[model samples]
Target: MTTTAPASGAHAAGSAAPGDEPLLEISDLDITFTTSTGHVNAVRGANLTVYPGQTVAIVGESGSGKSTTAMSIARLLPPNGKVTGGTIRFGGKDITKVRNREILALRGSEIGLVPQDPMSNLNPLWKVGFQIREALAANGVAQGAQAKRRTVALLEEAGLPDAERRAGQYPHEYSGGMRQRALIAMGLAARPRLLIADEPTSALDVTVQQQILDHLDTLTGELGTAVLLITHDLGLAAERAQHLVVMYKGQVVESGPALELLQKPQHPYTRRLIAAAPSLASRRLVSVKERAEVVEQARTTAHAEAPATTGSIPRSASDTIVSVEGLTKVFPIRGSVPWKSTPFTAVDDVSFDLRRGTTTAIVGESGSGKSTVAQMVLKLLEPTSGRVLFEGRDITEIKGRDLLALRRRVQPIFQNPYGTLDPTFSIYRTIEEPLRLHGIGNAKSREAKVRDLLEKVSLPASMLQRYPNELSGGQRQRIAIARALALDPEVVVCDEAVSALDVLVQAQVLQLLNDLQAQLGLSYIFITHDLAVVRQIADHTLVMERGRVVEQGDTETVFHSPQQEYTKRLLGAIPGGSIPLAGSETIEVEVDTELGVDAEAEEIAERDGARSPLGEEPTDPFTGAGHV
Candidate 1:
């Protein structure tokens, strides 16, 4: 094991030599978690380095030890987890040998960490500004009114809108992207030498993700902070990082320049990852004919066997399964007068149709009323006005057995697999619960049905005895899909279903959905914030903003020739759209001197017309509504 110290003095930006000592180094690293059953080796012989002002990305699937390795640097590992053998050096000091107090002091002052899942990381009760102030206070950066002012400045630097007003808001009040930005502000409050961002943008929208990354790149460059980004998005890694580290099964499989590794991957796992990434599946939306050709080509190239055929279930473009018309949902907000309340329209005059055996995607940022429409269609929530017709029948007024029948026909696959699946239920029980509820079969027959569903979702029958906790995020989601299909539903509502998954798992899940639709002639109302996924699976698209349908058309027309400005902005927000894998265009990080605080405030006021670096609005007013 070996470690190297960072350069003692300042150096020109992006001028680090291959022979120059790294700011942080890790060698022959190994980590293990002590569990009740036994000790699990989490990391093995992992090696990495981060030079001054360099952005290095570690890319891998879940449980590949990327987060484990990065968390070990800050000693943020859980009590049961420990580094068995490794050398972690930061600025000439060996972190593994540092005392508790020394490591505590080194955390925010030397190496700042932006943890994954802002909803879990941020203190829900405290104000966002207070949290930022706490970070500043810990590092002795500012105090009193100065600290408050600095917090707002940091928020603005993070590209957050209404920095002053947002600073006074609670964590629950902010959107996922806003909460993430708050965390980033806290992480960079003291301007640490190295920033360890663990899946920082996983929960964010594409445009917000790009903006946050851009701000980090610019600010970190000015401060000369080295960055170690841990993520599963291979396209993001390729686009942002100078160097790439590929991890598989706790081992460093490959490491090299980002573009070189992406273009010509040396490891089989890396190649498989690239193939499974949905963002890299197609650069842009294609015509239906083109999509079919591409799918056929992929099938022929990847598999020696002939492609599987769809079932003989008949479906046509005009056969509408779920029809929504002039749907509106309003909630009453308590006003200053006890007896009176203000009406808040969550969904207003929204209309869309889900055709038989085809996927119709509702695309928008958070709070754009996508999920509200889905809930209305599913009869989970009644609209304040308008109607939902299921199979040419009004389901809005249906109740009792009728609603139960509707449940059997329309099922949902929610966003978080961890939250959706019951932890106490085994896989067999989880899948069979739906069958039991619908009285489809006897106990013995239900078990058989569960086993069949397991096979359908591509899970082994042996997993029937395993509990939800025993499964990975991908596996749990597969179980959820199996459970949803237990009663042979005709329509499925997938609400941000694959947003949290890694690219590889997301691709597999999307394929599974496509296959199921083909096999059973099922229709889908896919609600999501990801435009990239919409381009892949949707047959038709509906663009929503502030509870209204901005645009609706065939997938090809909507994506290729968008008639709405919001739709165009969504398309433009896709990361790596302009940047290519083979290109030599580096990430430019020049600070914008023209962007002042008052100017940013003014931009916030006129956000609807103003544009981000990607030529989109900075904030969506409805971005916080009805999200998972």
Candidate 2:
């Protein structure tokens, strides 16, 4: 394999000067897809360049042509997609007009790709080691025992623990972060000159994401490979890339140094993106005065509305709506022996309380058992041991008509809007199904209710006729929220609800939730891995690790002066946490010192320095397993 010289520039580390000839450059690039309607232009005269050993990022929302542009460089666009205009030069060669044979040869050996979703990208039928070996053999890197040896080395370099054992496992057996690392290992199997990582760590925890990026940085540096990172996260882009390319509606709105663009974004769309990111928002909770005002608003609104003749009304803040005590869920793992299985504890004695009209967020990395606890509280799964009290009644024993009532009172907005909403149902029908099932009103009244719900979510009534496939990710999520509210649920369980949305859309959806809470006196059980999100909306927080609540307290107290080492590490891993922004001098103040923990508690927490349940290894803070 060959490599290009390092980028030259006056800017900070990793950036290239514009005067230098770029290793890969796209000029006046245009891409279009043949849709059922007509030819849809996905990329419009987009221009970008990547210098040797430089890290450049393309930041934009969905449908902004970021992925389309990256795919065009590798000739990996979908069947319906085609490059109509422009020149794509790679290493002084025009790849656009290259023959099919040449294009195939140039892909893995010269330019590698790490797709968005590891689960979908990886072949489920094959072991991870076999896949890496195949990539090596295809690229003429190695074969036989030599290839197997190289595969283990790649896995180890990608930061997977026990690489020899993990390589023999299927994709489903590994955690999400581990799967992503496997994908990265495969992408780097051939040691290509350029690596295109598309939304590489969007679904990963902050700590895991940081670790993956750090590994990528280290390996790419050793190999002198240029990196073109495509993502929707501005913070990640700012933290990792030297140059930032801002895209909007298939056009390049702005391109410059990462810090410059972040500190003082010149484009209107770029400004909007930064403003909408919760991770970039103020870290501290609302002041006491502000919270009081919000509570007053909710009280006035609730009083003005007619009292519910049926169903439950909103309780006061002091009232505990849901109490989880000694919650434990143990799943039996079957071994090779017939009818022999060992118990694997998923949730181990976790406990928390959800106060009325308040938000209690459960946060941790994937496989931390946060979802299991949530399922128990929502009565979707029965706890192996412990009790869940909803309105002073044990939900486990509730059945028949009473259980149905619980379902109406506690609705759920799942993580994947695409999967949760039925494709066959129209937006109006989707929202009306819950109302009809509950026998809330007549046909005309149900139709009116759907419209009201849409309006509440800041969606237009015209969208009522559209199907799930016809809407954007943000729009589909809103429809899901509308459906959840159609039954007038008091406690809405949001399970990774905003994880898939773009920064701007995520901010809108979060604000919508807050507004609805204040207006309807609704409480929430928000489960997510993004601590930045937890800080923005949660009043109280429960930090989970290995099926147990390692730390629990008010959001401000936990964030400002965390007692646990795991909590401190989690807080420190936030992207751009230490990077100085243009307008903002400091990251959002997570707690007011005056109201925060006293000196005594801080000393005790430091002295204790409790070890994490997962482990105390210096690997990814999200996953305790260290790099081999």
Candidate 3:
């Protein structure tokens, strides 16, 4: 899209319309990091601009220079990095050459920055009230009680609950989603002319992500400030950003209006990304191939069958992987006053059952204690009261090896792969560690099995040697899945597993999980606030709020007819609320091979590299037999 516009609603390339000469101007930017290994070009010859009141998106995978370019513009690059070439003029002043002292003054005032992880920006020792006011005071906006009042107002404006009381708490007291909101409040505390967000919602729950995006749209809509949204989520960028720039490695591959580019992508990478985005539709669970023709088109066609819904769930015998009865975690509100006895129950009496072969997703908003439940389930927290049943056994009383066994069975996949996946380990070692520890296999077998596991997650075995930093976001997640699946555990606790992934990558991972569950009879405790995901994979549903199960039922029942007001609000929060489920998309496919019926299973085993039981290796995974 052209940066220049006409007079009535017009803007210029490096400048805006008369009386609106663009909020930021950037050109021929080049960022370099002087590493011990030598110079690394983190960003190369980038060009971008944010107008007076427009949002522009820079989309790319990790290490593609999107974040590097944005950080350089804000002069917030890592110490080793520098703006080697380029001129960044914000409101007509050259930011690249500006003095370090003056740069701080310009920051949070002329331009504000919201880093990827809000938690990193906040200090636990300091009250959020002080942090919020710090930005305001730095810009000479206000000080003392006046700044405090303004901070509270901004928090309220950002849609945070109990604004005044929450302002008194530290960052650790807030949930992942709420912390992000507070960070937004701090960023907008100074009412800067331009705000640059680098994956602002990267680690937040889906519902919270939507809320934050909505708040941003509203806040910016009223303030009429320019926003530069840097993200890897094409779907998200499409919704929030007016224009889009697709970066690859250190160069821009495509640039156009967001919708226009998304609807019809020019780059192959972009096309793959869009085509891969997760759908609201149910995923097919079966993986046995039948014929070559069907196998060729199966990627878009396979539909896994629903689980056996035969007998009533036994009160005792029927397998129950996990159960929480009236579980609550509370923190005493400590103050200088000795007599104060106020308490905040972050997770209040939350209870649910996790079946052995089904998926149950917990959906909710920020501060809803969705994650607290996960932490509690992980035994990372001592529940203030109530019992956590595991395999019909109470786990709270059990510790040491018992707890270790529970952890091995119910593994977690965090939102941020950059943080969650160990950077020091190779994909092979990461996946193999569990297998080796759980005594699944010996060294040679483990290495071979690691390759097989990687293939199951749709990754190449070659990547086994590469470290976490070398892989893509989707790849690292696949490795995470491989590591989780290594032990062949009865249950996998995917706490926001695909939350941070881009749409396409998320769809692929979801499909992989579906495939894995069906093949291995694996159960999932899929904790998330994304209703769309709940509808797609959850056989059962649990709607959580303030640490309580407001509603729990079958997936279809929860999605189609919610009995609780909270459930209805959650369902409504979904972006395209309640789209019909009985439609299909069409795409042409071509196949070269025609395998005989008998050879199909063997073909699939060999191709996919899936292991057949403990010691046996299967045939190709793409055998024609699995398709039909």
Candidate maximizing lDDT: 2
Residues 1-628 of candidate 1: C-alpha lDDT, one tens digit per residue? 2211222321222346655677888888999999999999999988887887788889999889999999999999999999999899998778998898989898898899999998899998899999999999989899999999999999999888889999999999888888888898899999899999999998887767877888888888888888999999887877778788889888888877776677776667776676555565445223366445443443333233221212222222345767898999998999889999999888989887776667889999878899999888888888999999876778876777767777877899999999999776666768877777766767667767877787788766656655788777877888899999897777889999998787877877886776666566667889998887887788789999988999999887887899989899888877556546542223111222121222323343354332211122112224622110
**Which segments of model 1 are wrong by more than 4 Å?**
1-20, 284-318, 335-338, 581-628
Q: List model 2 lDDT by residue over 1-628, tens digit each.
A: 1111122342345644455567788888999999999999999888887888889999888888999999999999999999999999999888999998898898889999899997688899999999999999999999999999999999999988899999999999988889899988888888898999999998789888888899999999889889999998887788899888888889888887788777877667777666555556544234434455554665465445533424343333446778999999999999999699999999999988987778899999888999998899889899999999887778888887777788888899999989999886666668888887777887668767877887687665556555788777877888899899988877899999999898867877887787888889887999998888888778889999999999999988988889999888788778767657754733232222121222333443365443321132223234544321
Cα lDDT for residue 627, candidate 1? 10
| Residue ranges of candidate 2 with Cα displaced over 4 Å | 1-20, 283-296, 299-318, 585-628
Candidate 3 per-residue lDDT over residues 1-628, each given as its tens digit: 2221112322332224546655676677788999999999877777776778788888887678999888887788899999999888888878899789888887898788888997787988999988889888888999998998998898899888899999999998888878888888888888888999989987776667778888988897788778899987676677777677878778777777666665556577666555443332222212122112232332222123222211222124555667889998998887889888679998888888876666778778767788888887877788999988876777677766666566666677776677888675555557777766666556678777776776677655545545788666776777788888776566677888887776655766776777677666677778787776666667778888876788899887886789999888766655423322222233211211121111323344456554322233222234522110
Q: Which ten residues in a row have the lowest lDDT in candidate 2?
A: 1-10
lDDT of 3: 0.70
- The list of candidate 3 runs beyond 4 A from truth reads 1-20, 92-94, 97-105, 143-169, 173-178, 277-357, 366-451, 458-476, 500-505, 553-557, 560-563, 575-628
**In what order do the candidates fall by TM-score, top score first?**
2, 1, 3
Winning candidate number (TM-score) = 2
- CA shift at 468, candidate 3, in angstroms? 5.5
